[model samples]
Target: MSLTHLDARGAAHMVDVADKPESRREASASGYIRMRPATLALLAEEGLPKGDVLATARIAGIQAAKRTHELIPLCHALALSKVSVDFELDSVTSCVRVTANCRLNGRTGVEMEALTAVSVACLTLYDMCKAVDKDMQIGDIHLDSKRGGVSGDYNRADTYTEQPTPIVAASAEAGRVPLALEGERTPSVRVKCLAELRERFGVSELSVPFHELASANVAGLKLALKNQYERFIDIDDQRLLCAVNQSMANDDTPLTHDDEVAFFPPVTGG
Candidate 1:
């Protein structure tokens, strides 16, 4: 038996907020829809065939917040003070993030209202663009924060907000990170950077530090790069190119003093 349902057979009783005094309440929720990169580019630069996607999604979210109680069996029909839905385009991830905020002065919190708003907003975007993009995936629905509740204020400490859009496009064979040999006995190495790495670390034909030559293993090099560009990189992305004198190498590759090495994002081509 579900606790949230009001069926007579259910074991739980309705939670009453009658004794509680009205307080200002606010809740925020977020979700995402991922699609092909080209489709995302179109959404950002040009309007869709079905009219403006942002306008429709925003209206749908507002309407969904008002009808939360009807959609959810146990939710209280909130007398919402305000409901705002916004979106941001993340080109690298090929995702559109939908954020919803619900505010009210009521006995019950409006978390459900906010969640419903985000959910429907994402759905509306998928529906309006389904004709052009069939591979759309909706995920990452989560409650970001809540306030004015018995449980106290809560916030998600970690949230991904895409920053510093990738500047360098796909690189051909000629691209390489800045490299220089300083010490007399040091081995010469060519370091190449591609895609996001190039822009994030700003390493383009630049001179290499004396201690940062071709001595460490591939794993160690990755660690060093991560430490140098931690803020701009996603640590989980360990898939980088390890080439020894133009041949593909792995983490086990022993970098010598005279090898050409490069780091690159996964190649994508149609």
Candidate 2:
């Protein structure tokens, strides 16, 4: 079973949030759907018998948020405080962008709720439109960010063009060689940001110094980081150390980046 599905044993269940305190929590998730222009014309003309496409999608998203625990076995049954859905049309791509924002005050955050809402909305769109547009693709589902927990705030620093939303990354045991590089390393070797690192390595945390980054093998890290950096910032070894050491974890939504706006690819409804 996927580690995401349950505890390590996969028998006795939900993660214990008993030690955690209640706080205001919020999560935003987004999804994309793309279809042919002819199907877009039909949707624009209300040619589908499904009535209002966006409205139905919104309802579906709301319903899905409430059922996240049922779908994901180990997720806690959260009493959602708020659920909101937004839709935007893209004439250029003949698609819609579906976003779901979920909020709650509890021991655990509502990231799963937000993600479930967006996924269900996209599925609903696919369900309503698939008869006419089987080619529609649902892609780029990611946690934009999350807030109000012990883990603290996180933000994606990369621009949207960097590539698909990063999942997570982490250093391998073998990859964690001593920081012994002399002056040979670049001012800053690109490291996989903590978010992508986590999904990739299944590690909950990482520790880095504020000095120049020294890794045994940073080739893959450089590639992943390059995929996200827009321009480049020239920093000395001290500054590099500070960034790696103080850099926040990737618990927040991946879409909430600093430079360019991050959006899931376009979504559509039949």
Candidate 3:
């Protein structure tokens, strides 16, 4: 299908939704932030430096939903009727899941608003706990569902499933080389640089072989990039953001050959 944000001449422009009939629209989005067990314990006990982490994050999410149009250039401003942010703590995974919902009677969908809420909430959680847990990861931000839009409704469960796919073969075959060979001909990780990182690095995408890294982890990946290119020397672990397969990741997060990795600067305005 054609993208609504593009005109027939393939130039970027806002889609005119003024002619569309107004309807009550709602959207839900979710994400999570993972941290150390000790950090989680501190958070549970309200012992962290930041006071009331969840409460602050919830408010941040709600505010983000209301101002999403200001952050995203093409989004239409709407009079949102309701916005809510909820947090669920999971001890087993040492993570907190954030879910946000937005509703409004308008011509446009509130999907971006809901997504912005979740994203900002996760980021706020990270910011609050960073003093004690610099290795925290924010990830899995996605739209869970939407309703009342002209495109109908959508539920993530109805369209998506988590299935592990093999990313590399065990050994060589024909012209292909095995990742197990290590230094000989290791498989590569697909790396993407987003936002300002793309401009700083002068390239949006590149690949790094598994063998080039000092270790199979996020830190290793960053170090390898810095070693290969002098301009990457400015990459800072504490300030930079990272994701693996669209989920937030920390420096110690392990990696395998052929994994999709992204690095970007900390986001602002949700």
Worst 10 residues of 2 by lDDT: 257-266
Q: Put down candidate 1 lDDT per residue, 1-270, tens digits, no spaces.
A: 111222222222446778988999999999999989988877887667887888899999999999998997656777999999999999879899999999999898888899999999999999988989999999988789999967778687542432212122133224434233233343334455545656655553322232563346666555544544443255336654445554467877777544455555554321
Residue range 158-237, candidate 3, lDDT tens digits:
85453423233222224633333333344677677776666777666666777888899998988887776665787765
Error (Å) of candidate 1 at residue 174 is: 72
State TM-scores per candidate.
0.55, 0.58, 0.61
The segments of candidate 3 whose C-alpha lies over 4 angstroms from its true place after superposition are 161-270
Sort the candidates on TM-score, descending order.
3, 2, 1
Better of 1 and 3 by lDDT: 3
Candidate 3 versus truth, CA RMSD in Å, comes to 10.0
lDDT of 3 at 36: 99
Off by over 4 Å in 1: 1-10, 158-270
Ranking by lDDT: 3, 1, 2
- Top of the candidates by TM-score: 3
- TM-score attained by model 1: 0.55
